[model samples]
Target chain A: MATTRKSARTTPAAERPHPDATRRSQRSRQAIYAAALALVGEVGYPKTTIEGIAARAGVGKQTIYRWWSSKAEVLLEAFLDLGEQAVHAQGQEAPYAIPDTGDIAADLKAVLRATVDQLYDPRFEAPSRALAAEGLVNEQLGREFVAKLLEPSLQLHVDRLRAAQAAGQVRPEIDPRIALELFVSPLAQRWLQHTAPVSYAYTDTLVDYALHGLAPR
Target chain B: MATTRKSARTTPAAERPHPDATRRSQRSRQAIYAAALALVGEVGYPKTTIEGIAARAGVGKQTIYRWWSSKAEVLLEAFLDLGEQAVHAQGQEAPYAIPDTGDIAADLKAVLRATVDQLYDPRFEAPSRALAAEGLVNEQLGREFVAKLLEPSLQLHVDRLRAAQAAGQVRPEIDPRIALELFVSPLAQRWLQHTAPVSYAYTDTLVDYALHGLAPR
Candidate 1:
């Protein structure tokens, strides 16, 4: 159910009527994000609530209500914020677009190795899995997550592959979108299904195999 | 949470005392399988219960208790039965072995196409997704399903790739186990995550990309 219960405000916070960057508001926003993420990780998506987040964040319920539209929206933005923090921790800029070193194989392999690390990172693992598990059954949320969170990252690979195609490192005929899945999906399945362990070595091999045909040249 | 409450009647049901092939027993078995699949598909894995399946199947709880120890076990067997039925309907032998058409690409492509069909099959899709989603968050059950259900199917791919290697169609150095994922996991991610549509063409493209590699030869 969409949480439209909040009485129509004189102004919706989504319009960002005021500059939202004040130190106090920033602290509260960070706390809310942390609270929402930790709650979802611990209790899962369905059990988590705005009350829980507000209490955990040491903020009033109205504060959260004023900032976000719904719990799902809160979590989605929280994950986005978390991803940004991770990229920052890596000393990278926002978006953390996949590298295009012009050595296509090395660039792809490097990014995938980083992905292996991210997939195993404890801070993100439980909540990401929880979100993913929910997404499997919840089609609308699944598609939203894919569109907002996943597809953007996937598109970076598409851009890298298109450059590779132009450089003649990749076949012009190959579809970059589908080609990226060759490596990405293997790591994803292994992580998602507990089918196997993921590692730099495994991802390195995937890049190798994806670029070089499995058959003897 | 393993169920060990059922008193062993000095004969484990796995060692069926009766042939269990009699028309009446077969009918009851089919009904039980149907009930288990239907219940889990509707209510999901955690909420599905032995009592529910038995009641729905028109069998006593003791009848179910006699056969399987837990709802998980019952659902597992029902899926296995369903898979077997699918194979039988294909006019194939018990294992639903991938074709060894002497052309590795054609054989792998053919198998993947069948897999795409199976992924889209309404009978398998919802229940499998439910079990799989649960498996993501439930480590023990996830590992159990992978070991028992998933690994066996993957081993078949390993076998096919091995034969292709023996014929020099695949590189001997290639590990068939990881090699198979190059095609299989893409289809799986698309189906599981709702990231994209599953079709014979998509699967066919996966097979081609996997075998030929994305790089120019």
Candidate 2:
């Protein structure tokens, strides 16, 4: 449940850009993120390169190499930045958690509805699909991405499920890790496999099904 | 839902192989299926070509073209043939359905265990992973593959669930299509993403979680 797969480190502070260059570095960083995302979305992971990212970002190759060691690292941080921007766009703080409204079903439904929106969002679609496709075949990257990008969100659900269990809303015998998947994986399959259309209604139903028994009470 | 995605026909009898060449044609067909699956698994979908399949199968280019129109079509049929082989390997009939033993939960767990075996099988894994990765990015192929390959199996689940509903083992109001995913998609996500290990115990837990509400028994 806890992902320790994020890369070991980035550029050290002592070797970092001075305050005078901080503004310029920040601008360059954003450009690199945009460029990385666009390149990956356009040409896919195998074809995407640090050279392409640097050229598209209008920065020298060393500028990219100094901060991130590989294209994968750049894309990983780019996705993190995208998520931060999405949060900030909604007038939230840098570290946003899934709202725990005390009502387990309602909270889960709300979060899944937001996820449905993210899946449908054009800006998120191409890049996510590209990354997910790469992950399907690339085991190392897949595990790393799931650890860093996916599991954190999943961990939030686990936390919520644990909280629900504390309140006796959920059965304590159920494993929160797997129980959360009861709702999560269905929506994911629908999106990733195009098995069905996604909607708020669909996610709401998932929450309902996960909470109430599928069989007659 | 029934899939209308399969192509109209295989071949016209008049243009088919002559009686004297029937055995040779059968051999060539199996070779083509093997080559198609292996090539796609090795080089992936885009780089995999009809020429590659024919060459690998040791048949002429025209031999492939005479039957299938495109690489996708070849892969699709190859997958179907592979599935039939898996069924036969299990000592099952050509058109196998999930067993309904008057217990919905038991039947679901049984089918999911079989799915877990298929997911683990080397013959099924490589080609399935390759095709699924391609489908993630290729909309046309994704829809077609899901309609042709995945939906048929899902329909079997639907039919069984409907029977359960009639037997009052499932809630009448529950939509079987979505309800089926409660147990099905978790196993799928674990297999697809390697989020966790899969086992018969795990799938059995899913059935229990689904059939008996997560809130309480």
Candidate with best TM-score: 2
Tens-digit per-residue lDDT, B84-173, candidate 2:
888888997646699889988889888888999998898889889999999999989999999999999999999999999999999999
Candidate 1 lDDT? 0.87
lDDT of 2: 0.89
Task: Please state the interface RMSD for every predicted structure, separated by commas.
Answer: 0.6, 0.8
Best by lDDT: 2
Per-model CA lDDT versus the true structure = 0.87, 0.89
Runs off by more than 4 Å, candidate 1: A1-21, B1-22
TM-score of chain A of each: 0.89, 0.90
What tens digits encode model 2's per-residue C-alpha lDDT throughout A1-217?
0221132135476765577787898999999999988888898999999999999999999999988888888999999999888877877664658887789889899889888887887888889999999998998999988999999989989988999999999999999999999999999999999998988998899899989979998
Cα TM-score of candidate 2? 0.92
For model 1, state the Cα shift of residue B141 in Å. Answer: 0.5
- Looking at candidate 1 chain B, the ten consecutive residues that score lowest on lDDT are B1-10
Cα deviation in Å at residue A73, candidate 2? 0.6
